[model samples]
Target: MRKQRDIIKQLTDRELNVQLIISQFSLVFLSIILSYILFDSFVDWLNYFKLSYYDIVYYGAASGLLIVIIDLVFMYIFPKKYYDDGGINQRIFRDRSVGGIFLLALLVAIAEELLFRGVIQTTFGYLVASIVFALIHFRYLKKPVLFVSILFVSFYIGYIFVLTENLLVTIMAHFIIDFTLGLVIRFQKRGANNE
Candidate 1:
């Protein structure tokens, strides 16, 4: 696997095809992490938000952790189909180092939830921002079924976050889903090697 710096360099400077995939996934993962962090921190920074026991247990801890476990299982069981692994085990868990990536993921997820679900949807009163959020998802996903599915999921997540008025829940849900997708490819490779 390319060093994170090299991958970033290729996208910003080299514009290499190989680098494009890494760059795309990395950027997405990074964004999610940042969103989550900001979502949690910004509210606290302003003394406007705090995670309640309900939020922590139902949204952050339970939903997020459970989703991660389920997704991880699916990912390992069906790698070729589920995740965009790019045939790299490192992409799944990367032996080199994950300090930077893990940190970024958390931050991005927090910030993003704050913006997309907690702040955007809630502030806009769900209907308006939910439509906008669903529409934006169109660019990333092509299939009609997938697009609609994501739209519905987005709405559900937004609603839950709004109901709870906590970004932590949204971030947890998002992280669990995304992290599982990333793990899919690794599972595939592992099974192949064993066979």
Candidate 2:
């Protein structure tokens, strides 16, 4: 573990960005292939992407705004607590462009939602899927508050999937939260650097 952390710590910002993009795309491709092989219908597994435009707009906006608000409240209440470690800031947000951040967040949101909500939740049900999602985000385990936040977000995403039966809704919501957060972090890092 120490060696792995050392290697990660040594990576330059561009190298880390490349690594993140490749890994996220790999996850997306592998999840689709595995879902197809296991379920015999990747489209079905994806909830057929059946949402209407209105559904997409509504849920996307609503969920996105809700999550941003929640995040803001959390940050306000525990300003130093959340980002005190600075590991993510140094690795992911350092010197990242807005476009780069958006692309990274979009890829991550799509890949994670497809695997966790579209495939796992549909297969294993909400409770198990939520737990699995939380567990995979093991970095947050040391921070119980963040861990619980992830669990809640996972369950919320799962619930949206259940309600809409459309992977697009969850995907959009995930993208919004990720993209918004990414932008916030990137700008904050920029501001800090300027200071």
Q: Write the per-residue lDDT of candidate 1 for residues 4-87, one digit (tens) a residue.
A: 434533342224434534544565565446545655554443332456777757866576666556545544676433443233
* Model 2 CA RMSD to the hidden true structure, in angstroms: 2.0
Give the runs in model 1 whose Cα sits over 4 Å from its true position: 1-48, 65-101
- What lDDT, from 0 to 1, does candidate 2 have? 0.77
lDDT of 2 by residue, 1-195 (tens): 554446778887678777888888887887788688778676567554875887777876588779888977887898667644336644675567888778777889888888887777777888988899889877788777788788888888888877887878888888888778778777777888889
* Model 2 lDDT at residue 92: 77
Locate the minimum summed-lDDT window of 10 residues in model 2.
Answer: 82-91
Candidate 1 versus the native: TM-score?
A: 0.56
Query: Candidate 2: TM-score?
Result: 0.90
